[model samples]
Target: QSEIPMQKPFQQVKELVMEYPVSENEPTEENSYLSYNLVVGDSLDVEKCTAFEVLDYVLLSEPGAPLKQALLDAGLGKDILGSYEDGIYQPFFSIVAKNARPEDKDRFVDLIKETLEKIVKEGIDQKAVAAGINYMEFRFREADFSSFPKGLMYGIDVFDSWLYDEGRPFDHLKKLGIFDKLKKEAKTGYFENLIEEYFLNNTHGSVVVVNPKRGLAAQREKELEEKLAAYKASLSPKEQEKLVKDTVHLKEYQDSPESQEALNTIPLLKREDISRKAGRLYNTEKHCQDTLILHHDLDTNGIGYLELLFDTKQVPERLVPYMGILKSVLGYVDTENFTYGELSNEINSRSGGIYFGVQVFGNAWDNKKTVHMLGIKAKALYQDIPFVFRMIKEILGTSRLGDEKRLYEIIARMKSRQQMSMASAGHSTAVMRALSYFSETACFQEKVAGIDFYRLLDDLEKNFQERKEGLIAALKELIHYIFRPENLMVSYTSDEAGYHGLEGEIRELKAGLCTEEIQGEPAVSVFEVKNEGFQTSGQVQYVAAAGNFAEAGYHYTGALRILKVMLSYEYLWMNIRVKGGAYGCMSSFRRNGDSFLVSYRDPNLRKTLEVFQKTGDFIRSFQADEREMTKYIIGTISELDTPLTPSAKGSMSLNAWFSQVKEEDLQQEREQILDAGPQDIRNLAELVDAVMKQNRFCVIGSEEKLQQEKELFQEMKYLL
Candidate 1:
């Protein structure tokens, strides 16, 4: 009796537009980072200009918005595309107004800034925010991790899939996704915060204004071309050959005294520290004071570690990333410095030639010796202070997508080798573990690991031809990926002279007592700060904040936290991880006395500027939004409730029973999550923003990128 009707094939994409006027600033460094444009003119025909709002940010219009054509007739530019680079992810804007007077620059920036402020002040439409939140929730709830690989691979191929400059595959993928029922049974309440996190912290975003600096632009382009050339040469021989044939005007480097000098400085690991607890190894050390504290975790019949870190005062900042790369590279390539093929050889030799492997940050790095490799883990060791800086640089410097070529090559070899070895009954986990551990130790996090220095030399040799374009393209993505504004570390610190620069910058607290009818009844008060500086400073670049209050008794003989939710994260990683020798480190923080300090994991006592700088930067930069909160909350909650495997649960329960982490602590941790609100987050954001402006960052990588990018390092305040 019922007829099923087909639904329409298309749904309307809704967009909201907000427009405002802004005054142009003098292009100071402080505001340079904010995308703004400079326009030159003798006078303003304010009536014939226009502006636009793209994504969530403001933009001036050389080209007005499609629907805002009417507004452009009143005085705005007609093009918004000038400020944005095609194919990049960041939100951007442009400004071009005709007949604007030379004196109008300041007025323009001011007008635009004011308009932006008004937009922010007027706030996001609650209804819109809610609908977006709900839609995201629905999408995530319905997402199937199973389809991720196919979807992601298809998306990646989009960059190369164009035929005759026309993109047909994009539509095909979308249609197939729906028609083939890959997107069916969609749920609407999963983790919507992933999208939120992407929007707020992606590196693709930038603010661009037209500047009359041809020299600067040219210099940037030249440098970029060189960098690009260097990167392309690092791929495999097949890829490299392809790049050469496909690209043009590529430059290559030659063996030069400058590079030689830089290469000579990287040092070898010279020490180790070991301790025992409860009949198991508890601590391990390497490369100066870098330390790792091990806990015999029953979960994997292995260990978990906590790293205690220090600043980079003991090491060079330039060397930090270089060393990391070297650690990874040296672990693999048979080294001239050591006989027996470095650690892999050593393990196979020790185990009568079995298999070996190394793992970095949970990913397989040296899978070649999988047969003889048993197990290995390696991560950088640094202090909490500049940990953020280290993370930023490390993520930026390393290849994204885990260098899929390397992955495939290593995997294929391992698979084939494993098959042959299995036939001989020679494949043993012990042998493999030994090899992996050895590589993990010798080559772990070396500066040269991910770099194609040899390729750069090859590119340099080619004299800017045969593979320049691909190299340049790769370099652009790598540089932009690493240097995206989202990676900048921000933090707060009082002046060494003892000035609380942030004290009055934020709104004062509005704490008041609430009492019952009884005159002596105890009461509670609500305290909150207004814009003494929340969103203004821009230091707390990643997170948002806000606050609110409810009635409670103040004199009820109960102590309350003035700064209830002071937040901190695992700052730096120490040598808690070692190949075949140590495990990963875990840090714990418990609220203590007046000022607080928590557990840290790191070995080196190297407390340098890089360490402190990065730590503060990370603290200042990280933003806690709904998505972050959801992921963290969900992941943690899931972990907490996860049943210990049959073997581990009993021990975990026994330990919890013995330690103070029984039901109460667990309940408290959960309650902390429940008690959090949006305003409290906003308040914390402001505090972080205020502190980050004056902080310094330290680096501690190797000789290569650092030496080559010294000028880059010079851009920041460096100590030693």
Candidate 2:
């Protein structure tokens, strides 16, 4: 069956390598995407499937994708992409040459084939393969999908076993087991053979060419109908009858509902098992070498988690943009001790990972104040703390900031990624833009990681040659200013054994850091919002309106979280998505009194804003039955109890301390969420109304849509 999978289709095809070109893209899409995909193997073969995943990481990921690099050198496309996809009944492999022309179709196919053949003849990089294995192994141990519900993510991982092979629901639950065997097989010829057997020799595949288009979906649908009709006509009468029956059964299954008895089989958390009090972090603050240190003694399986947060107050306003740029390039450029790739490999081999980012810790009780800092987070085995600290010192304190070419490459990549993510994350971008009008906390966020940062990246990418020397100079000076002993604060999470060696390492880390003291007050970056609209090439608009309730004399409450659930799942869902034809909408009320009501992929901009404006009315008149209230309280609790890694816990504690979110506040909020009533939500309606009345808004949509609502915005321009 496997040998002849594509034989029937092959009979009607004009070529073994088929090309089905479609002259269209998503509605109003500004750019075209090119993809090359083929069915390789399935999840049923665990060893081979896992090997393909590792191979994809080595050959297709950033920091280097050698095969994709070859394609880029050939000028076939602007970006090269390839990957192995599993966790399904029939998994496939895909290689895309972004921005490549239709004529380069054959060139892409040929290049992929030749590359595989060359690698098969020669050998793959053992070190890279090991790094790939280590990478996934560490992630498996971490078991942290901080962005999503842990149980839901686990279900996603386990579905392959339960859905595909119900005989063993927990078949794929053991990920590390697969990795252990894979590590041994990788050092042999198993991966190469797997590649040849699935990718090189597999013929059950098709080529798809997608051309850019706007407002041509109807034409594409009609073409699909004609082709489908022709294909159906080729079938025998009995075969066609079976196809019709099968389709009817499929639809019936999709519409089917489980019986109440079957539903009762699912487990529920009893009230007795639930914790009444909130979880408290293990934070023991002290001082060492004139640096503030917060230690979290937690079980980490011999792993040490350390966070270095240096206050950004000393950074001059002029250096803000450069400091943001430094976050993207540090730990990713050539250091005096190691090249970026080598350093990455070494880090993976010995430790979990070393990373950098900018953080804004706004006091939950006071929006008027914030703790802005540059953060470096590292995790490694207790045995390897010395190596991790050395690596951190090298990258954060002495990275080669003068390499213009490498810096340009990093910024360009950053620009590409930011642009790609902007399409789906426009709602978030809009919120940041809207809140920057008044909220200093949002101002700092937007400067480092939001629209302001994107603008900086855009300007730099377009004119890097002219901006190179000065930008590098500013980054160098800012890095020095940031890594000083005075600004550095540390947080470490580990067993006592991990801390046993941390004191000496902390001293060494501090000694290597800059000791300069500024003579005067530290400068701050000030930002002003334009109340602008960003015109994009999207079919729908991301409409957002935000304001801080603190200005309205309102404070944060646990009831706000319950209201969040109701609005997100009920009010906004019904008004914006179900009735208004938008994809989704949500509202957020943070402890700092910042709030935003936003719609995702909304069609009518004016209508969405009107819906947002009426949200307070919804909450004021809101009523929930006992069952519904219980469900919402449970939902809020679910969010509050997200599974956090040890490292993540340490980071959270550090941020909480800086933000003034104390243990009593957390426990009080938990109790409030648990015992919340309809009145609790209703009482906040006045605050919501006052916040919405501020009328600070931002919209990111197609140029046509933005033009239609042009009166709403003070100014509008192209987002990218």
Candidate 3:
């Protein structure tokens, strides 16, 4: 054997850099909006710039800051105000303003440039920096680590640090010191120096503008098809045969069963690692006057999470469209004693966030009963509890909805956001629309966020000048029904001391709201939802099929959940993603016994649907041995043990209490999950077969694909 010459790490890195030369500007006219990105040459090393990044976020776009206000005034309010992307070789700053009116693009760019020059000359306000530091500190301490495995988070940190040649990965102690140092530096004008040196002085930069042109998506699809056809024609018959063989071999390997001895070698948490005891439930309910209070005491490190749920039973159905917009517009507009800017700054300084939204949950005792709530959710420091309560009162009691110019601006901005969401999250949109046909909760959700909601927003945006009076009246009516004391349910999560300290203040706040009883039975209206496929100009496809098993008097078992995991990870992944080239595919089982199969960023709608239909057969034929069952059981239990933030824990407890999901029920579910065998998976295939027989589905995809499979859908609609 001959020894090969080895290259040093630096040489290897240099060679790699030379292989992929950075492009100054990649031109594109494919987008439906005018998108701009201004990139700077200088690198902001991650280890050093983390604090400055946080500080800069506050000054440039912190809700009601001057820069953001300037953009809003310029009709660029929907733009992504300020965001930075760090790179290893050369980091760059980005100021993106997308979906801008063609006529306003020039002015928008000029405004952004002017704002940057002013910041460079005058420096940021010290008060803003201080508040930003406080907010950032709170966020760092309350970081949510429940979505993924803790070990995965740690691994990612380590890998990034190693790749960037930065310092060691951060831990709780290390982060505290880092935040303290950053705050001290921010107060000393360190961010101003960064602005002048890295941004103002750096001449090496590029301005990329993506302008929209009609039929762009269609043209691109045609070009792609032609290119693929040419490539296939160029390939030799032997090469094509080999490619097919390779694909089949790969699928075989993915579906192969592992032996018990082989599985034992892989690293995993054993059964002993799981705690047999159920999660701690910490909610205590009390009544103050007519208002209901759900409180939880947890170690929150001197932070408080307060959420208010106002019953929306008395809200008239006519005002539903206006109620949909209330959450976005409420805290963002002027109040009686404060301008919108002042209110934004006040809330940012005292709390993590103060947001309002609509929430719906099924009643525990009667699944047919739907609880529609308008929720005001907020989080604050223990000392700022009084201010949080006061602000909530002001927002509910004194918010002015009559500012015509401001209201129009808010609606326009909301329309822009919804359009963007429709493009990127079409899969979720399709699933919501499909599920809406079968379940009450799903129907309400669709009315609020689905295609119907998008249509309502579009009409308001296009005909605002004509519909102004009706819109304002509807908003005012919504406020009247949703802000009464009789409809209030308050829930708070904090340390024991924080809860006791704020109890009196909360009671006083509740007493000030209207005491008139909301006299009505909950609104119940049956809707005849059309089974439809929606068309969009998106490049990819999203397909969803959902069925309501509960309504059919069938309930989900632990075996069905296990079958879902197997189908999603093994069968669907292999067929829809690996072979068919979708980005992702999943089968989800909801607590309400509703199941949905969704394909994300898929290329083929008809093929993906075929794959979904085959799931029942796949599950029926699955022959997992003892080791495979153990592996899946362990994986499921690991998810159950995932840690949640104190605030999240409190919310989960409250939801469980309200839903009457007792500890025994959860324990039994866990047992069923662990005790599930291969036979159970085969039995659950019957449920999958039954669900597929309904022949109900909704797809959001390219118009070309929708037209090709028009007969598969009962009705077809265009999203944009």
Q: Judging by TM-score against the true structure, name the best candidate.
A: 3
Separately for all candidates shown, the number of backbone clashes (residues 3 or more apart, or on different chains) is 167, 0, 0
From the highest lDDT down, the ranking of the candidates is: 2, 3, 1
Off by over 4 Å in 1: 1-326, 333-669, 682-686, 692-720
lDDT: the better of candidates 1 and 3: 3
Candidate 1 lDDT score at position 38? 23
Please, what is the TM-score per model? 0.20, 0.85, 0.88
What would the TM-score be for candidate 2 when compared with the true structure?
A: 0.85
RMSD of every prediction: 31.3, 6.6, 5.7
Who is ahead in TM-score, 1 or 3?
3
Cand. 2 Cα-lDDT: 0.77
Q: List the lowest-lDDT window of 10 residues for candidate 2.
A: 11-20
Off by over 4 Å in 3: 1-48, 76-80, 87-89, 102-106, 120-123, 149-151, 154-161, 166-193, 236-264, 267-275, 364-367, 515-522
lDDT of 1 by residue, 511-575 (tens): 11111221121111122221110111100011111111111111100011212222322232221
Residue 60 accuracy (lDDT) in model 1: 23
Pairs that collide, model 3: none
**Residue pair clashes in candidate 2:** none
Off by over 4 Å in 2: 1-32, 74-78, 99-115, 147-151, 175-177, 206-209, 213-275, 516-529, 624-628
TM-score of 1: 0.20
